[model samples]
Target chain A: MNSASPPDLLTRSGSGLLNWLHGWRAVFRFAGVAIVESLTPRTYNSATRSVVLKQIYFTAWQILPRFTLFAALLSYVLIQIVVDTARNFGLADYALEATIRLLVLEILPLMTALFVALRSGAATGTEVVLMNIHNEIQAIEAAGVDPNRFEFIPRVIGGAISVLALTAVTSSIALLIAYVVVYGPQYWNLPDFARVVAHIFDLPTLTILWAKVLAFGLAVTVIPITEALAAPKKLFFAPIAVLRGMVRLFFVLMLIEVLSLALKYI
Target chain B: MRLLEETPDAALISDSLPLRANLSVLENVAIVLQYRRNMNYDAAADRAWALLGRLGQTDSAFKRDPDLGSEQRFAAKLARALILPQPIILIERPGLLLPDTHYPAFLDAALTAVEDLFEQCWIVDYTWNEPLYAPR
Candidate 1:
């Protein structure tokens, strides 16, 4: 039977607070573990490379074509709207800059996070939680296998690369789309496109975007694994662990975006 | 008897305990592994998964990697999946809040696929459960 009603505000807020705290604590802790684990030689073994590559291959490579198309369409639509609206307002000079900012700095990576979250985040969370609940991670450890290097860090690395790779591909294509829409299909705007990339992606913006995408990807994998570990060793909390992971992932993605925007503009 | 004899469907979560936290995943099992009748964590976990069937519990998580699966299909996939089964099979809750964005579908499909394997599957813990325990 369903509760047929939501929890009272006090309970809802209390649990929300707890979940928020616990979720972040897990993230920081996972990060610390990853860093320490990374310092060790075994964590970077051949197995780790293979695992990381495979993770990137599946999570990033398989979806490359589809993600690029989706990003292209979204970028086209957005640039058209921005360019048209900017012209209507007689600020056509700012149109390209605005489109790049919107598409490159803001939209694409976040969309990638959402895509990974939908595709891999859930799976990672479920897998980790199951592993935690099952004791698989420990088994690896007991067998002289550093699970972090062998299993987890590869995931983190893969996720970061996926975000970067996807961003690179989509941002590149969208810039082309933006120019085609703005100046028609001609070489005249190549200089302008390069200028925008140079201007909008100045050293600071480039650094921030790179950092933000990395952070976003790390959060996507780290948060879920942390929450999965936090799940009680009972059958009921698996979904809850994943749920917490997804919510925390979204929050972290938003936070990364805001922080990057702040670093760039503010 | 026949139904009870089937393999139990159980989930298993594996993680290193935060160093700051008193209960590393291994330490959390200190009670069962070290003190209990002289079984190590691996042995204890194996024992636990086996006991689940008798408890009428089909799929539960053990702190061991039983036949592990991945988030998605990939190259060399067969090689990794062929690795050892998790040592402990603990029972955990269904992953709702963790990190699965493809919730209703990925999990739903998985659970539905494993339905015939277990007699009964229930989620009762942090992040473990089983949906594929063989029927008796």
Candidate 2:
């Protein structure tokens, strides 16, 4: 009760706000640096290409078959649920539209983002933090390597590609599963299914979907790496940085997904 | 013989090395430096001399001596000397040695050391059962 008075408290609160702003100023500045580097011709080196390839291999290539199956099964189950529910509510005509919107555009990207975020995001965060702590990045820079181009930007590119490839594979499988669930192995409905695909994945919708996936991937890899790099060499703060990165990544993924949904639906 | 109670404090002591950096500041700065160029050590030293003098090193031998006074002092000096622009994480603390009353001062000093050395800083801490890993 005898702490700083109201005016003092206001000053303290303003200081906290200023502190938060200062922390983000560094982040935004770094992000600007990343963007400028990304626009340059040297951004596409062999190392960068290899990092992108490795990210794709780990994210999309390795689990492609499993993710497809999982997406297919999940799509089938969800299509059935939506169809049955819609039919019970006497809106069976909306089954195909709802299923496509839900499975292909919504759940798949979010699931892929979460999956990648969990696997690679944590690793990237820890790796960046350790490198920061150990001064390895400094060593690299001292040796005349642009650590951002050589090490980081490539990861960002790789992550975006991985998200795109994974989403493509999963969405395709989900589409196939949706058809099977709705029409039950009948070739007669193939054209009808194609029409729905065409309708749902219209140009604008497709563009947004792809962009969102890319953004999701970027958020997962970039945010964590950035945050980890933000952490001090103190090992204890490493985990906290990671935690913050993950939370921010999760928030960004949700925001991207919701923004995409709002753009598509509303 | 009075046995020290094996509370968190005792556990903290047994694991001194792990907690050695417990109060240290950690930072990762991907980009830094007001200016960078290919320069010889002599010029770099000349540039860094004033900043080095301002540091509160008590030992005259350490202040003027070519050799670093300690591991921590050397790191702080090198970052200033080299002007290398890279992501840096620096941890500075008296470690888990001081009492809680003195921790704030220790923490401030450690952070100041790291902030002087690098742009990014993290304060590593320890709690019960936090995962500690050796770098591969």
Per-model TM-score, in order, reads 0.62, 0.63
Model 1 chain A lowest lDDT segment of ten: A136-145
RMSD of each: 14.9, 15.5
How do the residues A136-245 of candidate 1 rate in per-residue lDDT, one tens digit apiece?
66644543346666677878878777878888899889888988888899997788778877878778778888888878878878888888888898778999999988
DockQ of each: 0.03, 0.02
What would the per-residue lDDT of candidate 1 be over residues B10-127, giving only the tens digit for each residue?
Answer: 2232122111121222222332333323445466445444433323222323222222122221101111211223322232333432244443344344445434434444433432
**Which run of 10 residues does model 2 chain A get worst, by summed lDDT?**
A136-145
Position B121, candidate 2: lDDT = 39
Q: Under CAPRI classification, how is model 1 graded?
A: incorrect
Lowest lDDT block of 10, candidate 1 chain B: B73-82
DockQ of predicted candidate 2: 0.02
| Candidate 2 steric clashes | 21
**lDDT of every model, 2 decimals:** 0.63, 0.62
Q: What is the lDDT of candidate 2?
A: 0.62
Q: What stretches of model 2 exceed 4 Å from their correct place?
A: A22-36, B1-136
